[model samples]
Target chain A: AQSVTQLDSQVPVFEEAPVELRCNYSSSVSVYLFWYVQYPNQGLQLLLKYLSGSTLVKGINGFEAEFNKSQTSFHLRKPSVHISDTAEYFCAVSVPTGTASKLTFGTGTRLQVTL
Target chain B: EPEVTQTPSHQVTQMGQEVILRCVPISNHLYFYWYRQILGQKVEFLVSFYNNEISEKSEIFDDQFSVERPDGSNFTLKIRSTKLEDSAMYFCASSEAVRSYEQYFGPGTRLTVT
Candidate 1:
């Protein structure tokens, strides 16, 4: 079985400050990692994904995440944030080598970028 | 840009009532999926449909839950008897193909079971 954990349920940051949202996963097989952002009353939009390439993956909205194999973590970061960036972010994992129907998601972290 | 679209942005139903959530995925997409998020909970997978059949389903997809692609463009999830626990935001999604894991999700249908 595979599972994802977003340790922080909520993280508040001042606008323009750097932010990091941590995520960890437990899986026996290789997995694909992704970060999705959800605005209020909106559907989830893909931020970025890590399949099999450079450990550092860059995404839209100046967000980036590092895939650490040893740590089994995919932590998302941004150098600066805007008030618009305040939204719920989810970390998801899917095993490509196995079943194709599922993407296990973390509980999500609400990022509140304030003035 | 192309995206998945779902109908009935919100629905209110009494317990044991039947509800059918609808979706229209992006054109040229081959795989469709349904997921749900209860208030303050993680999104959970319900089922995946491809080639007009269910490719996979989770434990939450029991005898009461069914999926169908009645027409070419519409994919629907039918809950025969909605329980209070079944109240959640139901999302319909689609991927370009079976190999594409990054799915495009619809705005979602917020089903409130009373």
Candidate 2:
């Protein structure tokens, strides 16, 4: 089984400021990591994924995340944020199988960007 | 870009009423899934389907819940008897093939059981 933990429930940042949303996971074996974003009145949009190679994964909207295997963490970051970037972000993990499997999601981090 | 689509953006029903949520996955996709998010809770997986049958499901998918691919383009989730706790945002998703890990999501249908 796989589980994801997002330490912070909410994060507030000023416009053009860098922000980081922390995520950690526990799994018995190798798994894939992902980050998704949801805007108001919309569905989850895939931001990025970490399947193999490259610990540093880049996502849309200038967002990126690093998969630190030793720490069991996949932290999402952005060098600068905009008001439009305010939304809910979720970290997810899934164990790879011969076929597609389920995704275990975190509680989600609400990013509130202010002026 | 091709995307998954769902119908009945919002649905309301009384307790004990049966509700069927529908989805249309991407044209070339071969896998489908259902997930729900109660207010203030994490998104929970309900089930996954492929080749017109359920490939996997979570405990949350109990006897009251069932899935069917009645046709080539439509996938439905039927709740035999909806409880108040069943009120949540249900999302439909799909992936291209067996090895594809990227799953596209739909706008979701908000089920409000009264």
lDDT of 2 by residue, B1-105 (tens): 888999899999999999999999998899899999999999999999988889899999999999998888998999988999999999999998855578899
Cα lDDT, model 2, residue A105: 99
User: What C-alpha lDDT, on a 0 to 100 scale, does residue B29 get in candidate 1?
Assistant: 89
Q: Please state every model's RMSD to the true fold in angstroms.
A: 1.1, 0.7
Q: Interface Cα RMSD for all candidates?
A: 1.9, 0.8
Each model's lDDT comes to 0.94, 0.94
Off by over 4 Å in 2: none
Q: Which predicted model would earn the best TM-score?
A: 2
lDDT of 2 by residue, A1-115 (tens): 8899999999999999999999999999999999999999799999999999999999999999999999999999999999999999999998888687899999999999999
Model 2 residue A94 distance off true place after TM-score fit, in angstroms: 0.7
> Candidate 1 iRMS, in Å?
1.9
Cα lDDT of model 1 by residue, A1-115, tens digit: 8999999999999999999999999999999999999999999999999999899999999999999999999999999999999999999999884334478999999999999
Q: Candidate 1's error at A37, in angstroms?
A: 0.5
Per-chain TM-score, chain A, candidate 2: 0.98
Candidate 2 shows a clash count of 0
Q: Which stretches of candidate 1 lie over 4 Å from their true place?
A: none
